[model samples]
Target: MSTAAIDVRGLRKSFKDVAVLGGVDLRVESGSVFALLGSNGAGKTTLVRILSTLLRADAGTATVAGRDVDRDASGVRAAISLTGQFAAVDGRLSGRENLVLIARLRHLRSPGAVADELLERFSLTEAGSRRADTYSGGMRRRLDIAMSLIGDPRVVFLDEPTTGLDPEARQEVWRAITRLAADGTTVLLTTQYLEEAEHLADRIAILHEGRILVEGTLADLRSLLPPAHTEYVVRQPSLEEVFLALTQKDTAS
Candidate 1:
């Protein structure tokens, strides 16, 4: 098996003459979190789609989970899972049902057991029977991710997983993502949130103009930019500070 969970070189794609990914290269280590940071239309989604086998690159080679993305597409598909921007849960079905449905589709022997296991793992056992429509944004996102893991894929692609989520909900999802890497699942995440990348990624690549502008740890990337200057200000004391000083003086007296 390849040491890298994902490997790409000279990747290129275009849509009717408008180039999306132009000679991009990336490497994601096994069991690590790699964040691709880009603004909307910067080709992050396009790159992910290509890696996940949903789309093919016009040029370049990609190997995902040790299988060539083009030559061994099926192998790539079998070893990876993807969750897109929006939660892909069925609103009418309960959380448990949604997982069971995915398990069945994946040809698991006992779909019900698989569903229960995932619910417990995601901390959704208490709400497993509730309709997905009733789930909070965080819960639904959790369920969506759980469904993606039905096959226990080696690599998981999360494209803007926290989009539209509240701050608390986003934090909840972040914890779940962190747990995935700790459990030895290689996560390739695409997001526009700079803080999200900094918080979750072991390494990050900034994609701009269909190319990688920089790739490294947070500190490494920061070092490439001009140094920041800090300004110290001295200001008049507040009323609280003045009162504290008078109280101390009286106590000493």
Candidate 2:
């Protein structure tokens, strides 16, 4: 079996005359977090959709979990899960109910048991009986991610998972994503948040103009830019630093 959880080469896609993905190449190692960063319409979503088998590529070869994306799509689907930008849980259903419903749909032998276990894992046990509509944005996102794990997939694709979330809520989801990687699940994250990539990804790729502008460890990428000069003194921390500090304090308390 191939050691990579996802492998793609010469990937191309188009919508009519405009090319979306132009000969892209990527590799995601097993049990690590790989973040794809791009601005709006940079083909991040198209790349993710193709890799997850939701959309087919125009040309080139790709594989997920050792299964060819085109020729063995069923195997690819079986080994991976996708969580979109918005939460997909049913607001009318209780948190536990939503999970059980997905488990049952997946034909698990004990849907209720699976739901209960996931609730505990996600720290949702206390709110499991509450309607999903009543949960906070963070809680709802956690529940959505829990649903994706019902099949115990080897690879999980998170497409802009923290979009529209408050800083605290975003941090909550970040912790959950970090936990997923710690448990040996390969994570493919597509996002506009550069800080998120720095926080969670083992490797990062910047997609621009239908191609990867750069790919490497965070430190490696930093090296490409001109070195910073230590000639100035700051009177106060930057807004991002203050925000992070405040959030960390809130979380600690």
- Which segments of model 1 are wrong by more than 4 Å? 234-253
lDDT, candidate 1, 192-214, per-residue tens? 99999999999999999899999
How many clashes in each candidate? Answer: 0, 0
Q: Write out the backbone clash pairs for model 2.
A: none
lDDT of 2 by residue, 81-169 (tens): 99999999999999999999999999999999999999999999999999999999999999999999998999999999999999999
Model 1 residue-pair collision total: 0
lDDT of 2: 0.95
Query: Using Cα atoms with residue i matched to residue i, what is each candidate's TM-score against the true structure?
Result: 0.90, 0.92
- Evaluated at residue 110, the lDDT of candidate 1 is 93
lDDT of 1 at 50: 96
Residue 172 in model 1: lDDT: 88
